[model samples]
Target: RHYGIVYDNLVAAMRAELPKTVRFVAGRVSAVEAGPERQRVSIIGQPDVTARLLVLATGMGDILRRDVGIERRFVHQRQSLTFGFNVRPAGASAFKHPALTYYGERVSDGIDYLNFFPAGGVTRANLFVFREHTDPWVKALRDRPRETLIETLPGLLKTFGDFEVIDRVSSWLTDITVAENCKRDGVVLIGDAYQTSCPAAGTGVSRLLTDVERLCMVHVPQWMASPGMAAAKIAAFYDDPMKQAMDERGLELANFRRSLTIDTDLRWRARRQVHFSRRRILHEIDKFSPSFAARLRGLKRPQVEAVT
Candidate 1:
């Protein structure tokens, strides 16, 4: 059983609704000053633009954060590596399922998971590995992806049917980080500009979406109505309850996923065994009797989990 979502089209659909006031600046920011009343933004090849408030949605690699005394504290220097490629059915037959997920079976494999799904008239394959970028296994996966993946995940071929690699593997090395001492005057940090998420955890977009909703839909309008854009006003957005909860959940999930995949301790090892055992038992029950499975769903366990 597997599930997946396509984000590229969703992004394109959202961009279609952008207001006319949203102008795209095509230049490097030479200087940024978070003034008490307004922000003085200077671009290398464009005229300076002053605004009552400035939001930094720049990525983790952005260096403009230094001017505002915001520094990234690396939580896990290199948390996970992600590989992306396109996969198509190898034979005349099509795959039974539109989307499929394959979780790593062994701790020693260092392979977290793999997802295959339909997107843009083709099937996309994404693999998440809890291994170093320079490791021999990582290099092997990059050079000979099909052969290496087949060897690593023997059940993959049987589960999803034969598939041919249709594109080059795109890889990403994620460094989990959180911004520190970012509370300043007029400028506010959001999305990857404030924190970097582990690709394996799948919390990156959730945190960023929360940031955008809390900042734009709620905080920004309220802040603009006030007299000055000072540190006091900026701190209010950081103290937002929804934003705080999402940030905490992202970090918690990062640790939980890493431990679930690689932790070989006694408790985690036992937990993993029980986790898969439960899923298997429920799946069996569903196959034999759907009504009986529905009865089990209401007993002590979550309806979704028991049914799943």
Candidate 2:
């Protein structure tokens, strides 16, 4: 079963594990000046500081990246909409399942999927849809979330039990983008600052963490062992095989999710039917011939070449 945790709580726990030597200066960054040997940061109301290398994990906001002449190329515009809200069992003590994923039954609904999971000591509902912001359903959903959800997803109540939404609804519109012209001196972009992922694909954090691992654990020490921090040094992290694969896979999965949810073409329709059927078949097979089912699954899995 899937589980969830509050983001702030997770961050706090991570912060507690940090070394005391690490100091955090809280200030708005006004500008950045990057060079081969040093990187200068200008804070709105604080003294300027310089570092050997600059790493940006600031997310999709691109003002800082733009300051360094880095531009983001849109892979998909307004790729998907994600809605978040808290829910509680209407008349009961608890829900039927602690975690559940409900897929869209009809293609016309433009709904991808809805996830109900435990988070922040409450049942959290996250709905992903592929539709325009101007769509009437978007407004109706914001205005009357519980009723609209039940109406849009008829099987929701029967499957997950009755629920009532609490607190305000939060929504995010994602645009798939990748940073371009990022091979610069003394600076590197990570996470959403480098590329934005579709929430539906569930690869955003995977790619972000991969960026951190490859840069810090692998490349940073190698770069620091030398003298100058040139564009060539920064390019090594970008050119890392693991980072490239994760970034490329994120985009591929994003496209796959969109096409799977909305495409009405014969190929996709057939694929979708086969997709569901294959899962059911594998489940039944696993119950009987477990070893055979495992072998079948192994055969269907994609092969990857070693990145050494």
Candidate 3:
């Protein structure tokens, strides 16, 4: 299934029902002042409303994080052109099975993982080429996105055969990548606000939603029931859970990033050792239960319950 299509359908469904139950507040949150019983959230437009609980889903904004003294580790520069192509099978040859191919060297090289998926009768492939954050090429063509796309597309075509470009996407400069220990007192950070991970791991959106759901379903309800739930209590409820989730994801992302992006020769050797060790661990797990590998494969299915 195309995620873009599914996302559009989901958005359409939400848009249809949004006006009925949810009130739309279209202004910026200027300030958040915590009090004894409720939080006084000051908005640019509305001034008279106060709530017992405040949920800020205001994604990865540096200004908001700075206000609460949360600093990030990895700088959130944009990932240069990761190209997607929709290819029609050439002549007598047909794609037998979909596969993800990882190519090139550890740190300085490009094309980390290229995924080929069945699209209708054709093949839709996405090529992820790693461009360094400090590269001069990225700096020169940063402002002109189309020029960057033009530069990256030819290389992708040469490596992966000729295919038509479907869509292109890039990350924002202001999008934050924070360290494991970045959390605040009064305000609760969820999603990308807490920590940003590399897209290579493919866990960012899932992790974010899981954090939100855990807080809303378990923690927030419990906090509401407490007799003396102050701002400190609310902060505590969010702190541990958010921190644990972010740390686990952050470590995984860092490992994955280091494996693909580190430029040092020594770091390459270290990553090779880590990769071999990880494979050995997997092999040992497979030996324990023959179906362990199969079950692990099944975990990638859409219906599988993700770890919170």
Runs in model 2 deviating more than 4 A are 282-308
Q: Against the hidden reference, what TM-scores do the models get?
A: 0.88, 0.91, 0.61
lDDT of 3 by residue, 175-198 (tens): 336534433334566767766655
lDDT of 1 by residue, 1-308 (tens): 33344676777677778888887666788878887797988899789988998888777766788887788888888898899999888884788668887899789988878988777778888898888788998888878988999999998889888888888899999898888887889999998889888777777787899999998798888988878898888898888999988887777777777787899999989867886787688769989998898677557853222221
- Stretches of model 3 off by over 4 angstroms after superposition: 6-22, 44-48, 67-107, 114-131, 139-160, 164-186, 227-229, 239-246, 261-308
Model 3: how large is the Cα RMSD against the reference?
7.0
Residue 111 alpha-carbon offset, candidate 2, angstroms: 1.2
lDDT of 2 by residue, 12-103 (tens): 88888888998777788988988899999999989998999999888988798989899999999999999999999998899998898888
What's the count of clashing pairs in each model shown?
A: 0, 0, 0
The lDDT per prediction is: 0.82, 0.88, 0.54
Best by TM-score: 2
What residue pairs are clashing in model 2?
A: none
lDDT of 2: 0.88
Higher-ranked by lDDT: 1 or 2: 2
TM-score: model 3 vs. ground truth: 0.61
Which is the better candidate, 2 or 3, if ranked by TM-score? 2
